[model samples]
Target: MIDSHIHADTRPYEDFEMMAISGIEKAITCAHDPLPMKSAVVTLEHISRLQKLDVKRAQENGIDLYVAAGIHPRAIPTDYEKVINKLPSILNNPKVVAIGEIGLEKGSKEELKIFKEQIKLADKLKVPVIIHTPRKNKEKVIDTILSLLSENLDESLAVIDHIDDKVVDKVVDRECMLGLTIQPGKLTIDKAITILEEYGVDKFMLNSDMSSAPSDPLSVPKTVHKMRLKDFNDSEIAKVSYKNAEKFFKL
Candidate 1:
């Protein structure tokens, strides 16, 4: 199984140990250069330093971990260009899988501009995108992304992460895979099964999105078990747990 999006800040390289015990084969460790925000302030440089440590930890653990570099919406600020310029080298890393965890948020015009620029860079790099959207403005943000992909839609592989029941329809309608975060309070097993039933399980996938928060890495298996209880067939359950994410991440 491949964990689509995970923050290595809090736990660092411990994921490999969890993967070994849980039978998870691979995990994508997302690295975002934290940006200054209006409400919450963190520096991109600090996050970058943390991710560098994460890469080293993964190497030491002997896990086949993939990393991604991006500027998260909440971290976008005026001085983003300095970090954005460094993205090319980051993407060139042999362990880097995609460019992501980047998208719009409820922020000022300046933030939106920076977000759009990163999207453009992702396009130029020709890699898949992992997007995070606000609950209230998910449709709009997704629409904007689709607009950007109008001409070369097939060239891009995109996953809208942290989707709930409310946004499942838009996700299915767009034919984009949905990334369900198993983090408690962020998403529950009940809602995830509902999405599978509604969206046909073909375009849905699971992600731990595990971070500094109190979350169980076991949530992924728990979600699979919940789908089983809901009468979803083995093949259907496999799609959500492994097939979809495997195809997306090319593992």
Candidate 2:
């Protein structure tokens, strides 16, 4: 199974081995933009370097690795200008599947401007996008993103991640893909399955956004197991756990 969204770049290298052992066969590791906070110092060049190491490490460990490039909402104030200028070349790398982990968080003017720019960049480059929604005022953020994309772009090319029941209906109505992240203090396995059960798994996928924070690397596999226990058939599990992501990201 491909963990459709993960920050494997920030975890210990052994995390890959753990993923393989836990039944995660592949992952799409995202490069976060630099933030003012002490922990966020990733630049485009930094993403490239990490992508190289990550791909090599995944191969050595017998796991497949795909990459996504973008500046996160928190990092916009720090590296937005230079990063945007260089993101085009950075994304040219064959392994980079989308331009994201980018979206609105603080809903600041600059954040919205950069988020729109990255979405445009994804469109210009003919690639998909993975977005991060604001923890606060999430419905407003989702509205802002959909409104921005409704005009010229295909909603299917964008993955509105970090979603919950609050905005799931809006996203589904917009015809965009939904990403459910299973992490501590966020969405859980039970809730994820419940969302799928209510919404049905068409343009949905599950992810273990396990990174530097407190999270479980085995979360994705566990969700898969839990879904089966809930009597989600193999095809349904394959859709949310693997096939949908494969179709969306072309991975």
lDDT of 1 at 140: 71
Tens digit of per-residue lDDT, candidate 1, span 1-251: 66677776657456657654675656776755433432212444544554577766755665456776677777765566877787788777667666677766764576567666776777687677787766567667766655655544343377778888766666576756778887776678777777778668788788788777777766777787778788889899888888887788776
Q: TM per model?
A: 0.83, 0.93
Model 1 steric clash pairs: none
Best by lDDT: 2
Clashes of each: 0, 1
Distance (Å) between predicted and true CA of 193, model 2?
0.6
Per-residue lDDT of model 2, residues 16-84, tens digit only:
898899888878988664335233244655577657987898777767998988888776545467777
Candidate 2 has a TM-score of 0.93
